[model samples]
Target: MGAARTSDRRRRRAVPWVVLGLWIAVLALTSPFASKLADVQRDRAVDYLPASADSTQVAKIQDRLPGGETTQMVVVYHRDAGLTEADKATAADQIAEIAGSHRLTGEPVGVPSKDGTTLMYPVASNEPGIDEKARDELVNDVRDVARGGDGLNVEVGGEGALATDAAEVYNSLDGPLLYTTVAVVALLLIIIYRSPFLWLVPLFVAGVANYLSMGVAYGLNQWFGTSVSGQSSGIMTILVFGAGTDYALLLVARYREELRRIERPYEAMVAALKGCGPAVLASSGTVAAGLLCLLAADLNSSRGMGPLGTVGVLCALVAMLTLLPAVLVLLGRRVFWPLIPRYGSTPKARRSLFAAMGSSAGRRPRTVLVGGALLLGALALGTLNLPGAIKQEDSFTSKPDAVAAMETLGRAYPERSTQPITVITPADRAETTLADIRGTQGVDSAEQGRTGGGWAEISVIAKDAPQSAGETTTIEDLRDKLDGSYVGGPSAEQIDLKDTNARDRLIVVPIVLVSVLLILIALLRSVVAPLILVAAVVAVWGAALGIGGLVFGPVFGYEGTDPGLGLLSFVFLVALGVDYGIFLMHRMREESLNGAEPVTAALTALRTTGGVIASAGLVLAATFAVLTNMPMVQLVELGFVIAVGVLLDTFLVRTYLVTSASVALRRKVWWPGALSKEPADPVPPKEPERVTAAAH
Candidate 1:
């Protein structure tokens, strides 16, 4: 029986390499097809366009209309007396010259402020264009011209310049951030494992998962005509490396433990897989489900992120289960060459801290449960004052183009720098047309132009700046009133204007919450379990937001929260927190079926799992902390909040909650079946004895 069992273990251990090879082949063959697939979709989408709806027709109509290329850049020229009419005219001329020279297809119109203190040049893009590279060149060229020999302190600000600057900031930080994160994680892993080869193992596996996931994401973009932006790229890197390393740690840690039990290396590998496979699968399933829930999001960008992130996680899981095990099998015992521990013939016995804690919790269930609840409740208090703001101006680093543009606008034409509100009134309605729109509340100025045969475009500049949510609300109310009061237009006639800020917030919140909830339920396999998990997740999210608001709002003078923060917080909390829950629950389940009693089982599980969970949490937290080195405010906030949340989940929630729950339920913890009502213990298999050769 022993020989047969050993043979069976060897076969199982060899299977993963075969699977890894197959996956590698699939990734290779699929990579080249990504570009081809994208081309096919692009061609089909282009061909299906209406004949009258060509790009030229759209461009011509937009240029001739008031709100066609309604967005503008504000150029702030500061001097002792602000700007005289002569100075304004010269600035305008200089701007126009630069625009013309640089092939800037925009209507450069300069208007001095009503106070006559600042000059504002509102340049509208003729092509409705905002290209990062082109905009950067235009801004730089304009800056050079405006500042040269004029002795005029002039600054150019607008969406184009701001976006270009933000991109530059990101580009500057990307290489350093990537290297730093990789280096930090590598060093941390080495410290924990105390093995150079083991450190490389996780890094190598994560790299494969990262690259393959990127290839898969490219394929997804090709198939769906989705744009994968820089944000998504950063997220892809974090997810693939952080999550991949996590799974590797779990598997390798178990492999080492199993090695201390079995003599043969192959037997140990198979034993480790059998023990760790289910836990890894559950953890991966939760993460994948959470990310996949992004599909339900209203925003195209976020919806794209769902599948992109999910692919990375799934790839990591596949690599951990297949490639990682295969590598271990091939390396055999040499993988841990220098650090092999001396072992006796008998299995060693040692009391684990997690086991002690679990035992205590099982003995005193109320204490553990109540204590945990109180801690979470206290943390959740910060959430009550949670503020949700999506300020694009604040999303990037302080040095980003967007921030510079906003600052320039605030200094120059604060009113005009604000985005214009487009009010669509039916042309057929004489009472609600351009003339009527000019008379509406808060309208500083109104420009009307024909959009089509029956639709009139009314562009209204607000009395106040448009960055605030209050401004957004005012615009929304104006639209509602216009639509409801104007009955003389076509029944289908409606207002369609983009609220970039509000649209971002609305799309991010539900998508993140729903995605996280789905992932929790999939992992826990109980409806109640997911609900509680999500509640904890929400608490963590709220805490993160509150902390961010306080730090950014008060310390940095950032007035409001960046919308991207909410979405990022959601993903990070879910991914990292779920890992904690998975680690704890895995051990909890194992103990419930193996330990002598419910209390003993809880104690044993905690002792065994607590150390690993803590180690994994520290690694993940440190990995996220690397984001602090990024130039972007969003990344910094995301890194800090996620790191904090991981620490909380790992040390406080996972340790206490699982222990308390195990004790409270006792035998009933298993529920409906009680795990067969057998005493929790590992039943040793009978060993076969060989017959004596002399007697035979």
Candidate 2:
């Protein structure tokens, strides 16, 4: 039986390499097809906006508008002395000449600082609205011109230009991020295993997973005709590294444990797989399902993020199960090498700190339950007074064009710098009947423009800043009041903007929450588990928001909370927090089924899984912290929230919840119905005996 089992393990270990080879081949075959798929879907979705009545009219208006570039570039000049009239005129001429040479469209509008030490020139793009490539080109052109003159200190800033510059910076940083994460994780694994072959094996599997996941994402994007943003690209980098390392750790740890007891390498590999496979699958399923829930999001960018994240996690799972085991088989005894522990029949110690906590929880169930609940409640209170502020100024570092443009706008035309909110009435309505929409409640001003036909564009400037709670309310009310109102016509048309904060929020939050809940329930197989998990996640989210509000509102002098902060907070909190919960719950169940006392099992699970969770949390936290480097307060807040949330999950939720829940529930911890009969407590596993023998 031992010989047969050893043979079986060898075969199982070989399976992953074969599967990996096959995946490579499949990738090769599919790589050529992606462009074709992209072309077809791109063409189909290309005219989505054109088919709409309002969009068609808007497009026509945009085409005819002078300096009709969708992007605006601002040039800022700062001097020790106040700018002379000659200085302003010279700067204006330089801007105009540059614009003319570049074939740009807008006239230079200059605004001097109140203190007279700073001057800004706002230049609109000359070409009919710029696309991504054109926007990038215009930014570079403006930068080149602004930096060329000898006597002036100037900086160029604009949303379009800045986004372009940021994309470049992100691209440069990506390689370093990937290299650092991979190198650190690989080195850690090497030190843990003390084997060169084993150390590199995980990296190889992760590399395969990364490439395949990217290929899959590209194909999906082509099929869906959606754009992938720089944020998604950054996310992919961390996801690939973190998920890949995590999966490898679970498998390697199990494989080492099995080898000590089983006596044969192949048999040990098979046992490791049989033991750890279900847990990995469960963890990945929960994560992938949570990510897929993003599909219901209203924003195209977020919707794209969902599938991309899901694919990365799923690939990680596959690589762990197949590629990892196969490498173990290929390496055999060499996998552990010079430091291979001696074979032993006895198991390690059963009673651990986790077990003690669990036992205490069982003894004082109300105390454990009530204490945890109160802590979560206190954290959640921070969310109530959360501010909503979503200005683009909060999204990037000071070095970006976007930040520069915002500052210029604030200085030059604070009143007019607010984003225009276009309220569309049906083209079927008579254009001559109604007045412009500028002076409506909560509106600063309104401008009316006519398309070639009956369509009229009403651009409403909000009295409040964009993405503020007040602006959100104002936009919501405007949509309700203007839509379906009969204005000089019997039939009223709908009023809807192509993009608005209210529309995006309503669609994104529910979709993300529902999808995440479904994933949790499916993985846990208990309705209660998902509820608790999500509730804890929500508390973490609220806590982050409250903390951010406190810091930004009083210290930074932010008027209100940024709206995008809410969306970003949800993503990091739910995605990363759920991961820790899944890790804890999985190990607890494993120990329980293996016949350890419920409290002992919980403790064993914690001691074993705690280190891995801590490491993963730090890596994830560091990744999020990178956002703090950006000049934008929004990104700063997001960085802090995610970083703090992960810390809380690792220290508070995982430690307390796992021990208490496991011990209090005892045999019923499996819930629904017991998956395994209660086994008599076996003799505890011994560590010293094996360690002494391995020294031989």
Candidate 3:
């Protein structure tokens, strides 16, 4: 018997090493693929558009044209007062030099503003074609030679230059985003764990999970042809670290509690897993299911994000559940260092903050519930203040050179658009299409350009400033008036993006709510419980956006909201915010199963799981907040709204409102489930004397 016991211990000791070995092997295999994720990421307008959109059709046909896709740009020469004769001469000379050095669709045409303060040269080339790098190089080369001096400002602005600048910002995100997120999580972990060594364990495991997610994402892109943009990949990384750390915190907290009762390290770890594993699995499953709903979205970016986000969350789940447990067991109680939980040791008695909050909630559930609802409703009204749909030039938090140029053009040519609206039609219908475009009410001019691949391209100028009301109307009119032809350009793409996002919200929102509600029902085994959770998250989402509406323009100085912000934020908040609900509600259900009264169960659950949930929320919110510091306005806005939503859900919604609602509902919170009805007193064991005597 002693020998058998010794063998069991040996086997247990070997398990952790085996798991570690397998992880190393897996990481080694995935590393190469992971490094190539950025290579396959595409950020073009068409890459994000719906396949059925007119802009998408035009872009596709352009790619099949004679020189692939044409790169269009405008070099703006401006002065504070008026362009001097020398400034005009310099602009002309530079334009000639650009013409001499590069192949052009036509001679660089100078369009001077009626005010005489600005002279712009429209340039088009097919040399760079569809090569993103070559296009960026072309734009940079133009900037180099078109230097402005002597009180004159020269700026490069156009579809091609704007795209190049946006690409640069995205390319730079991988490094700083990863680094800052790691730093933020590492710092938060240190504070939460209060152990120098323990924080490193989860942080390292999260990093591994991040690398694994990237590899899987790249594989998705390669094998399934998933569209990955800087935005999606960046979001995937955030989920890896945020959700991974959250799982770690829950497991570690449970393990600490178990260690005080179980003598063996491996046994305590097993006990911890038995206690929290179901909740963690359900939490990650909720997130994965919510994100996967994006598959129903028409937008390519949103749809691709579903899989990439699911990959991140699932990868984090795998690592935290497997790798984290193995490492913790191997390190045993020592991993916790100064605050280590020794076997058979009792923790100091203290009144925790969550206990106090829960006590107050239990005291007046109705008031808390009503007040919280009213507050959330009031905050949601702020959505009315949200700015209009974001403009292309306003997409960046820090203005790029292209944005500056566009601004100059906007001021200089307030009555006319320098940016052309591209129209693609069958070559056989070129003359009729050109004539139709010219007759369009808002068109200032229309000119036929290159013809290839059975199609002809025509560039149309609007009668008003770019992306303005008049310009948008003109685009709509062109699309409606022109038959058997597609009207597209940068502006057209934005219109399609806005419309697609609205459609996706209508379709995807209900699907997400239903998916999440069903999962909650299955996991909690109560309809009312799931409904409460879903509603609470939805409220949090609305309030968060309301907060964004109030601040996005006034505080952040942003001019417009991201088109995808509404749908994406709703998906994330619903999926992730419910995570805390799961942690709290699952614990409450456990207390009820153990025969605690409803109010007692709710308060007890809150007291026990509150600290861990709060920690996880802080970590998640902070990781996303790192995005607010990013360069792109869309990312910043997304990060801000999500972070705000998380905080609200954590402090107000989860701790107070959810607990209060559960308390007020009592056993009905689990209606129709066995717990809904009070269990009858166990027959006192029939023979209590015999049972006690036998035990003694």
Candidate 4:
């Protein structure tokens, strides 16, 4: 027995070093792949669009055309007071210079606006083809040569230029997003722990987990040809820090409590794992299941996000459960410094914020429940104010050069569209398609441009502004008029993106709700409890989106909303919000099993787990809040909604509504489970017989 105990202690001492060594090896292997994740990320509209969408088909067919893919640009030269003789001469000279430099599809034709204030030179180049770097360089060269002076304004505007500008914003997100998220998490941890050294452990572990998730993401992309974009990768990074830190907080809090009871750090960590492991596992599993529900979506980005998000969460889970415990055990109790939990020493007793909250909730369960529901319902009403799908020019928080040019075109050409709608038809029917497109109701002008790969491309201009209702009607009319032809362009892509998102919301939201509810039911073994949690998270999601609706346009000055915002935010909020609910309900269930009354168990659970849940929620919310400071409006809106939802869930729903509901429901909260039934009265233990001094 003595040898067994000594051997166990030795093994425990050796385990930390082994874990550290293994992690170092894993990091070394994964670092290369992590570094390469950026190379495979695709951010084109086609990359995000549904595979069967007409716009997606057009884009794919264009790539197989004569020159692979053309880089089209329109050089807009405008003067508010109309072009003078010298202004025309200057425009002519610049047009000649551009034409001489690049291989344009046709001669530079300057289309003067009816008001004579704007002159746009239609320029198309097959030189750069499908090479993104080359395309951006070409656009930059055109912008450099097409500069204006005095009253004149020259702007480079086209699909190619807009893509380049958007790409810059997405590419710039990775470094700053990671740094900001790490900083926010670190600050929150320092405040929560109030211990310098203890905070670093979890932060460091989360960073490793982030790196590992990136490597794994890249592997998935390479192996399965999974679509990855700057959007999905950025969200993945947020999850790594947000969800990883959450798991760390729960583990650390439980470990601290155990340290005061158990003498050895190893034994205490084991006890901590036993205490909180099921809840952590169940929570992460719930999140992963919810994210995976996105696979049913038709949109390419949404489908790809399902796996990438799950990778981030599962990576965080593994790191928190393994690397976190190993490090904490190795560091032992002094890692907490001034607030070190000493074995056999009583902790300082004080009233906690959650305790006061639980008391109010316990005292007036029904009132609190109804009041919370009313507040959520009121907040949800703001969804009516949400802006429509964002347009290209309104996508950025700050106006980019392409957006500036597009705006100029929009103002100058109010009677006709500056952007061309592309139509691809079978090569055999090229002439018929071109004639049909020209005869279409909304057609301003139609021209045959490129023909190759068994398809012919036609550029058709509408008699209305880009993305306007009239232009949409024109595109629809053209689509109806021309059979077996794929009609597409920037506006068409936006239309497809918006429609697909709406469809995805109907499909993915239900899947996420059902999957999460089922997981909760299995974890809690109670239908009513799971229903309450699902309803609470759904309310939180609505309230969060409603907050976005109230603030996105009015307060933040955003012009429109991203098409995917509704579906993505719902998935994230419901999945993450339920994590706190799990912590609270699981603790409440444990207390009930230990023979405490339902109301007593509910209050005790709240008082015990509330602080940890609050801390975790704050960490998660803060990490997401970092996205609000990002450059793109889509990222900012997403970050804001999710952050707001987390706070509401943590402080309001989990702490108040859930506790009160449990109290009100009493044993019925655990109905169909053993705890729902009444137990027999406790029997006194038999007293031992006393021995006389003579007997001894």
Which has the greatest TM-score? Answer: 3
RMSD of 1: 6.6
Mind giving the per-residue lDDT tens digits that candidate 3 earns over 1-696? 678778888998999999999999999999999999999989987789989999999988998988888899999999999999999999999988888888888998799999999999999998888889889888998888898987999999999999999999999999999999999999999999999899999999999999999999999998999999999999999999999999999999999988887777788788889999999999999999999999999999999999999999999999999999999998888899999887667789899999999999999999999999999999999999999999999999888999999999998888888899999999999999999888988899999999998999999999888888889999999888888899899999999999999999999999999999999999998999999999999999999999999999999899999999999999999999999999999999988877678898899899999999999999999999999999999999999999999999999999999999999999899987888987777222121011111121
Which one is best on lDDT?
3
In model 3, how large is the Cα lDDT of residue 52? 97
Task: Residues 65-131, candidate 1: write the lDDT tens digits.
Answer: 5434333455666555666656766787788786777543345666666666666665645333323
What stretches of model 1 exceed 4 Å from their correct place? 1-27, 30-71, 80-93, 102-107, 114-117, 127-141, 148-151, 170-174, 341-363, 411-418, 423-432, 449-458, 484-557, 564-568, 676-696
| Each prediction's RMSD to truth | 6.6, 6.5, 3.0, 3.9
Q: How would you encode candidate 4's per-residue C-alpha lDDT over 1-696 as one tens digit per residue? A: 678767877888999889889999999999999999999988888789998999999989998998877777889999999988888899899989988998888897998988999999988898888888888898998988998999999999888899999888998999999999999999999999999799999999999999999999999999998889999999999999999999999999999887777778888888899999999999999999999999999999999999999999999999999999999988989899979998767678999999999999999999999999999999999999999888988989888888999999988888899888999999999999989888888889999988998999999999998898899999989878889999999989998999999999999998898899889988999999999999999999999999899999899999899999999999999999988899999999888877788898899999999999999999999989998998899999999999999999999999999999999999898877877777787334233232221221
Q: lDDT per prediction?
A: 0.61, 0.62, 0.93, 0.91
Write down the RMSD of candidate 3 (Cα, Å): 3.0
Per-residue lDDT of model 2, residues 177-244, tens digit only: 55766766676667656676777888888877777776776777767765555456456656776777
| lDDT for 605 (candidate 4) | 97
Runs in model 4 deviating more than 4 A are 682-696
Output the TM-score of candidate 1: 0.80
TM-score (all chains, Cα) for each model: 0.80, 0.77, 0.97, 0.97
Model 2 reaches what TM-score against the true structure? 0.77
